[model samples]
Target: MTIGEAYLRIAEDRFRRVKGLGDGTFRQLSERDFYERTSQHGNSIAIIVQHLSGNMVSRWTDVMTSDGEKSFRNRDQEFEPADLPMDLILEQWEKGWETLFNALRNLTEEDLLKTIYIRSEGHMVLEAIERQMAHYAYHVGQIVYLGKEIKGGRWESLSIPKGSSDQYAEEMKRIHGKNGG
Candidate 1:
């Protein structure tokens, strides 16, 4: 594959991994868990989902032609308490990811080099993609952390269990011909 193709593949894989972490966390959470906050100053998973969905729709829609921070997006409102149903909250989360994936699907290698505007500042398409990836990963980490806190000892491991690194490595080596990381 070409460099651009490789980059896109890796980027997509990384984004999927991040999303999978959130997905796994969600499976272990109750509907009320979505609304729970670690502290009064912290955001709930619901609010994070809302913010992410709003950001994805705004940034990915008309990605190349329009500024990422769309005029229609209410950044402040996304942080407010989302008293919506679990289904609706999940729908918004899926919608955001779908928007992002759709936009990524439509991109070409050449487009990576082209400049895009985010809040009126110029960023190459590749830079913009990385920026969003980091941003989403940050929020997903919060979701996972909160989920773990809520579930405590009952929380299932999204990755290998804490004390199983050696076993995991052996398993990986067995599967990947002893060359696995």
Candidate 2:
């Protein structure tokens, strides 16, 4: 297809991968694990979720016109631990992704060439998407790493298990070939 179409496809694919990693990790965690930090100053899963939700809401709400860093967002507060239930935190996580995905779905090819503001700095729409996508990927990596650490040997592999790369490659080839890829 067109360049914009390709860009959108790639962006959506990466976003889905990041979401899957975080969600899969979240499933492996217990309630206490959500609040457990790797260190005294490190972030817990709950805090990471809070920060992500806050960022998603701020950046995606009125994304086409308004500055991405919303005036009402208390970014600092996202780092502070709250006593909210795990379900509530996960609800917020879903809301954030909904907002972000909705915004992405609404984008037109031309919109990618247009400008948007984040923290008063102008960025092309595609650039803005790339920025946020990378940011979320980074945090998702953190969340997955923390989950793996906490679960230790019990953590279910999200992708190939530790020594299964050769088998995974063969399986991928078989599956893709069967689908005419």
Candidate 3:
């Protein structure tokens, strides 16, 4: 994969993987469950998702020609809790990812080195991507951490459960070895 494609792949994987953990075992939490402990300094997963989506839409659309931070984006409002259902929160999550995928889908190899600006500073497309990947990862980490903490014992493991890593790896290799050679 091209560097851009690789970055996009990693970003998509990390985002979805984190979200999946919440959707299954931790789905019992309400909007209040998500927002209750977070202070003003921290945002809820919904806000983080909204902000991520907004950033993706701004950065990826007209990427080379425009600022990554949109002129019309209400960055602050993203932090304010909306009295919407958890379903709406999921919609925002999906829409944010869709916006990102839509933008990433249009990229070409030539676009990698193209110049883009964010907050009036110039960044190569790859640099912008690295920046965004890091940003999303920071938030995804937050999402997963919060879900795990909130669910406590009820939370299911996202990777191999507890002590099964070796077995999981061996199983994967065994399953693939016969098909390949």
Candidate 4:
């Protein structure tokens, strides 16, 4: 019911969105394919997962009490291409997010204003959560886009399909009704 709780909900929703992307489409690609760099500027899915895990672990552990960036976080290594297997990537993803959500689940509404540190700088608890949500969303967008490119026309739209905005709006209006506004 608090803003942090709302963030947890969004995290859960988007985490599922990230995982769902790999469900069917990933199986079509071999390790070599999954590891394949789709663009000169972008990392493969494996590296993105590594970064996500690193960020989650660093930012969530002892979040309200300690610097979010831990002493052991190897920040530089996150960007390096990793020969990580799909199973390992999936494991890290699961573990990282689990730790984050578990921590969030334990937070009280009063705790929202408590300060946390990241990179030795101060952040309000809600601010840090919002920051990471934005970061996760940025990467999820990349993942979806890259996944679609890799799958070509065989890929499904991760969101509303082309030219279907009106249909979606109409359905929402019918269900919720204009007077509900």
Better of 1 and 3 by lDDT: 1
Q: Give the per-residue lDDT of model 3 (tens digit) for 31-83.
A: 66666445657666666666666666676667766787888788877767656
Residue-level lDDT for 44 in candidate 1: 93
Give TM per candidate. Answer: 0.98, 0.95, 0.80, 0.82
Instruction: Tell me the lDDT of model 3 at 53.
Output: 63
What TM-score should be assigned to candidate 4?
0.82
Q: How accurate is candidate 1 locally (lDDT)?
A: 0.94
**In the order shown, what is each candidate's alpha-carbon RMSD?**
1.1, 1.6, 3.1, 2.9
What's the CA RMSD of model 1 in angstroms? Answer: 1.1
Total clashing residue pairs per candidate? Answer: 0, 0, 0, 0
Please write out the lDDT profile of model 2 over residues 1-181, one tens digit for every residue: 8899888888888898899999999989898999999999999999999999999999999999899999999999999996899999999899999999999888888899999999999999999999999999999999999999999999999988889999988888898895659
Query: Against the true structure, whose TM-score is highest?
Result: 1
Looking at candidate 3, what is the lDDT of residue 64?
66
Model 4 deviation from the true structure expressed as Cα RMSD, one decimal place:
2.9
Q: Which ten residues in a row have the lowest lDDT in candidate 1?
A: 172-181
* Model 1 per-residue lDDT tens digits across residues 29-121: 999999999998999999999999999999999999999999999999999999899899999999999999999988989999999999999
Residue 124 lDDT in candidate 2:
96
Lowest lDDT sum, 10 consecutive residues, model 4, at 21-30
**Model 3 residue 168 distance off true place after TM-score fit, in angstroms:** 1.1
lDDT of 4 by residue, 10-74 (tens): 75676566556645445555666567787797799778878888989988898888898899899
